[model samples]
Target: MPTELPMFPLGTVLFPGEALPLQVFEPRYLTMVDHCLAQPDRLRFGVVLIARGHEVGGGDDRTGVGTIARITSCRPGGGARLLIGSVGEQRIRVDEWLPDDPYPRAVVTEWPDEPSDVSDAAAGELTDRLAEFADLFARFSVRQGRPALPVPVWADLPGTDGDRGFALARSLPIGAIDRLRVLSAPGPGDRVLVLCDALADVVAALRFRLADPGGAE
Candidate 1:
């Protein structure tokens, strides 16, 4: 069954098990936060990627798939703005988008990953590939005179294989579209495939840059 949820369309994608921290300054979102805080037990909202347009002020195209963000903490920010700390808990598919009556609302259904067996070896390979990708990207960043991006500590990853995969996907410094592809994957096995492809592409690009600083064929 589909249930109504407060929708927050952002320029980025949020994966399950990822932390989401937002600064709420807009009147509409502030109201949404207040409403959620009022119902402590139901302090949750949906976060979807804005296919087009800006995050502030309205009028944006939103994707149908998103993650449920459960509010863990809320406090005041500079000048009446709100600081919210939340974590993505589950995936959801939007069945219908409601009007922005002060805020965006959607009728969505839980979209859990389909069960699939992921062998220990397969999981280890994914992790190794992710590590390689991260290392190459970091080197590429430094070569471009930018600060090296931080890598996630493998020891701190989630317990289950599926959860760890989602965490790895979330940590990837990919673009919104690519991140959305991972978020929209059907199951853990499929998601791993998508991630591996993305990692390969990135690694290749980084290798190219590292080889010939002048990005040429």
Candidate 2:
């Protein structure tokens, strides 16, 4: 049987193992939170990146695949709003969309991650590339004079396996749709290639930024 869950579509995609802190104020979402809380497990809901439109309104399109968000902490936010701390759990593929009179609901099937056939050497190289990407991004941000945002250390990620593909995707700066594409990838090897392609462009751009500050921005 497909698991039915409350869907909260936003402009951002949640990669498994990512922690998201969100504010819930919309009436429908408040009700959705209530539903999640009533469940036996800690309030768990589905989180999808909106395909189109904004997060503040109805009529937004959403991606079919998303991660389950397990609420870790919930507290009052000023008035009727709520401050929620959640971590991405499992990936799910939306099989059906239910009515959203109050809040979004969906029937989804589990889309568990599949490992890759990457050799030990390839895996180590991939991990090194991720770390290098982080260092480059941090340096680029500093050069741009933006507040320093440290890149997530790839080793700290759970599991020392192929799924680090998604881990790397979440760590780097990539487009929303691209991130979704990574999630939909067949296996870790594919996802790693996708991320590597994106990283190439980003690294080149950062180098350009270094050479001609006015040329790249």
| Candidate number achieving the greatest lDDT relative to the actual structure | 1
C-alpha lDDT score of every prediction, in listed order: 0.85, 0.80
Task: Report the C-alpha lDDT of model 2 over 11-115, residue by residue, as the tens digit.
Answer: 998988889999999999999988888866738889998988999978999889998989998899999999999999888999999999689999988787676
* Model 2, position 146: C-alpha lDDT score: 79
Ten-residue region with minimum lDDT total, candidate 1: 153-162
Model 1 / residue 119 / CA error / Å: 5.6
Against the true structure, whose TM-score is highest?
A: 1
Candidate 1, lDDT over the whole model: 0.85
Error of 1 at 62 (Å): 0.6
Query: Per-residue alpha-carbon lDDT of model 1 for 43-154, expressed as tens digits?
Result: 9999999998999999999999999999999888989799999999989999999999979999999998888666666566667877898788777777677887677654
Write down the TM-score for model 2.
0.85
